[model samples]
Target: MFNKLFGKPKAKGKDAKANVKTVATALSSMERINENLDMLEKKEQILQRKIAAELAKATEYSKAKNKRAAINCLKKKKLFEAQAEQLAAYQLRLHDQMILLEGAKATTDTVDALRSSAVAMKAIQKQTKIDDVDRTMEDISEQQDNMKQIQDALTGPVGVASDFDEDELEAELEELEGTDLDEQLHESMSNVPYAQEPIMSSPEAAVPIPAPSKRTPPEKTPVHDRSEDEELAALQKEMAL
Candidate 1:
């Protein structure tokens, strides 16, 4: 995504390896020089001991009255001092050379480190960009939202209509319930026996009932009216009793 933002990396691996190799070589040379300096120091110490021994021999010779032997010993001591001075100069030159090489090695190593760091920074810049990161985050958020919607759709209740009216359904259910109750009441009434009105035994009732007369059948009454009449008859029977 960020390829266009940073371009390609430069070629520097071979150069870095070469610099490291040079530094290694210089460090090795410095180590050898230090070793030589150490050897020179040891030689100087040995020469100092020899000079001391020669002086002691000269003192013994002079005490014994041997002037010629004492003079020869002093000449040998001078020769040893000259050699020690030359060795000291050589050791000093070696120290200088080692110091210079050590400094060069350190410089080379520092340059290599800086170069590696720059390369790493360049590579990182090539692989990332602020705009790309922002776009990617936005895309991730959008995908999450889409996934949530998809999951809701998949897991949502089936066969459940959202467009229907709950109030209407409730009202219809109430109507059905009322109808069922009415039917049950009707069934109960049908199951019960109707009560007969009792005949009164009062003086006002001395007139006998008339004989049956030819009359047309009564018109069919509504079921509710018939039920009401039966209930009224049952009440009347109770009152008569």
Candidate 2:
């Protein structure tokens, strides 16, 4: 374990050595098997040649009218044929062993790979727990919330403006608008002449103003106004000079 983190792992070294040993063993076995197969093949071919030779000899003996010699040659050929058959059987057995070894090697490699993957997955599970993952995600969410709060604090409206009431501001705005409108109205009034003011008429350039119509009961002369007619006749007599 220390070597895995610091340097070369002892387990790896051992596995490599074991792999090399297995490969060497397989290579050596294959070489021996092939060598044996080659020797068996050569031996079988030699036996076949010997059988052919014996057959030719037997034929020659028969042609010479020698029955015993022909029979002996045929017997030798039969023995060589049997030996060749045994060699073929041995070759077949070696081939079967070679095939089995290769299949077993392939199976071993596949199992080892699966075992290694399982170990790695086990190690990863040991390092990363479900509880730890949940805690990490929770921490991330908490940090995000904290950061959002900080950003809001940084960018938010501040001090008096932030605390001001919308109602008060609207009321103040309306007051200012009212004051400005009053000023505009006063300025316009100052620039215009008053339409309701009475205009006095000049006696020399007199305009014959029509009197307003009055109701007879409301305009009846009182006794003092009727007695003024006698004074008006005495004033006209003094003006006759």
lDDT of 2 by residue, 109-216 (tens): 666677678889999999999999999999999999999999999998898779988899899999999999999998875565322322323555333444444533
Query: Residue 65 in candidate 2 has what lDDT?
Result: 99
Task: Give the per-residue Cα lDDT of candidate 1 at 100.
Answer: 82
lDDT of all predictions, in order shown? 0.75, 0.74
Off by over 4 Å in 2: 1-16, 139-241
Candidate 1: which stretches are off by over 4 Å? Answer: 1-12, 133-241
lDDT of 1 by residue, 6-82 (tens): 22233357785676466557656866887899899999999999999999999999999999999999999999999
Clashing pairs in 2: none
lDDT of 2 at 31: 69
The 10 consecutive residues of candidate 1 with the worst lDDT sum are 1-10
Give per-model TM-scores: 0.49, 0.50
Report the error of model 2 at residue 121, Å. 1.8
lDDT: worst 10-residue window of model 2: 1-10
